[model samples]
Target: MKLQQLMSQTRRAIDDYGMIHTGDKIAIGISGGKDSLTLLYALHGLQRFYPEKFDLEAITVDLGNPDFDLSHIRHLCETMQIPYTVVKTEIAQIVFEERKEKNPCSLCAKMRKGALNDAVKKLGCNKIAYAHHKDDIVETMMMSLIYEGHFYSFPPITHLDRTNLTVIRPLMYVSEADVKGFCRKYQLPVVKSPCPADGYTKRQYVKDLLRKLNLENPGVKERMFSAIINGNISDWTPRIR
Candidate 1:
């Protein structure tokens, strides 16, 4: 049931967003974390029987952290029979030194994504996928509304205006809990970000708050997800993927 839900949600997101087309090659960005790992698994499953066939390449952006390893990721990709590419980038040092801020989350994320996009393009993929899930969408909506003085969140599909490349978030409708469960069930080898910041950053703060709220009101995150998906802010348009 869990796997079905995960796959169903992902396929619906992909079909609804037109993320991939016949004969197109896509880059699935796997960070070796649970979310990205699950994304690869889901895509691998989809590739098994997708009528409109497409090629998928699993790519990981190595942050040049000493603790980072592509061995486990490589094995998983080989087990799934998908090719893997690792991009070497000094993102950790760059963000730590050049980003003179109390928190380097924003800059680090941007740099990592930019590096991944560039690498994917060079690797012959015009479409890229990220492993952002339901919780991420809700948290981003909350952050935008509370901090940015407006309501906004990541879209299911969009073209990076500057690069004219398409980005897809197939896990948009799936929950992070489901992802963790799926990873455990499959015994997927997981990797962690080896930095002091690790997963204890500001996003975790919001996630913790949401978790506590969920204890009292389990409907909170669901409501947030619905609002983001069903609510409209303005006439701001989106370019189709």
Candidate 2:
């Protein structure tokens, strides 16, 4: 996907969901993956012409993995003129070594988000942007139904009363395939995650399952995505402009 296409879809999500406001400061979460990097570029490009005139800072929660690296990410941020920060944490050691829990994804996510939230607040950002896209929305809803027995997915905009911060998914309209294509087309300096449980998590299982189902029933993914949009779940509908 070209930058123009990415920005166009991002603007649609931002406008439909009432995400950005004038003078808003947003911290873009960077996981060093293609998705997050793609989001960083999208938001950076959007900053150039969006009416809201928001400021952006890129942040990452370092999980204390020996192999984890952020040099390329830092340089990318520098090139884009986006300030970058990395909140250091021993989350990986605590989860894999100290706790030794069989299911660590949930705990790890909580800890990482806590760190990220604290950093965003310290940095005085009122909003944070995640890299979740169209594929993640459908997969999450599927995971909820298969595991917890109900229809649920990440909303485009969520206000956290506890932290007094708003979370927005501006890339919600972009597809994972498009993100991959964008990354390859631009030669983005992608960073490989060093997490041991990278592909062994439940989300990966759901992603693979969705891919197989899509293969068996072509266009099933799109239908599931459509269901998410029209499912009438609380806060799923876009805000009226």
Candidate 3:
């Protein structure tokens, strides 16, 4: 996808959810993956002309994976002129070496988010943007229903009262496929995740299931997204335009 298309979709999500306000300092969570990098680029583009006039920063919480590298990511951030920070943690060692938990995704996610949140707060950012897109939304709702017996997905804007931080997904309206195309088109210096459990997670299973279900029932994904938007789940409700 072109940068113009990306900014259009991103702006829609932000406007629909009232994600940004004047003087807002937002941190972009950079996981070194296509999605996060795409988010970083999108936010950087938005910073150029967004009326709210928000500041941007990029952050990555290193999981202590030896194979993970941030050199390319650092260069990209420098080229964009966005402040970048990497918080080092032994999350991989703790999860895979010490705990050796059979299911590390949950624990790893919690620890990673905790580290990212703390970093964001310390950097004086009131809001943090995640890279979750349309595909993630559908997959998460599927996971919630199949695992926890609930019909739920994350909202576009979430206010974490505990940390006084607001989490926003500006890519909520953009599809994952579009993000991949954008990364390829722009030659984004994408970095692969070094987590051992990268593709062996429950979310991957749900993602495959959603893909098959969409193939069997065309427009299923779009319908599911529409349901999420109109589900009246309190948090899912967008701010008044």
Give the winner by lDDT. Answer: 2
Model 2 segments beyond 4 Å from truth? none
- Supply candidate 3's per-residue lDDT for 193: 81
On a 0 to 1 TM-score scale, where does candidate 1 land against the true structure? 0.92
The collision pairs in model 2 are: none
lDDT of 3 by residue, 1-241 (tens): 9999999999999998898999999999999999999999888998999889999989999999888889999998999999999999999999999999999998999999999999999999999999999999989999999999999999998889999999999999999889989998999988888888889989999999988999999999999999988898767655668
RMSD of each: 2.4, 0.9, 0.8
Model 2 TM-score is 0.98
Q: What's the ranking of the predictions by lDDT, best on top?
A: 2, 3, 1
Q: Tell me the lDDT of candidate 1.
A: 0.83
Q: After superposition, how far is residue 120 of candidate 3 from its true place, in Å?
A: 0.8
Worst 10 residues of 3 by lDDT: 232-241
Error of 1 at 25 (Å): 1.3
User: All models: lDDT?
Assistant: 0.83, 0.94, 0.93
Lowest summed lDDT across 10 adjacent residues in model 1 is found at: 232-241
In the range 27-112, model 2's lDDT, one tens digit per residue, is: 99999999999999999999998989999999999999988879999999999999999999999999999999799999999999
Lowest summed lDDT over 10 consecutive residues: which window, candidate 2? Answer: 232-241
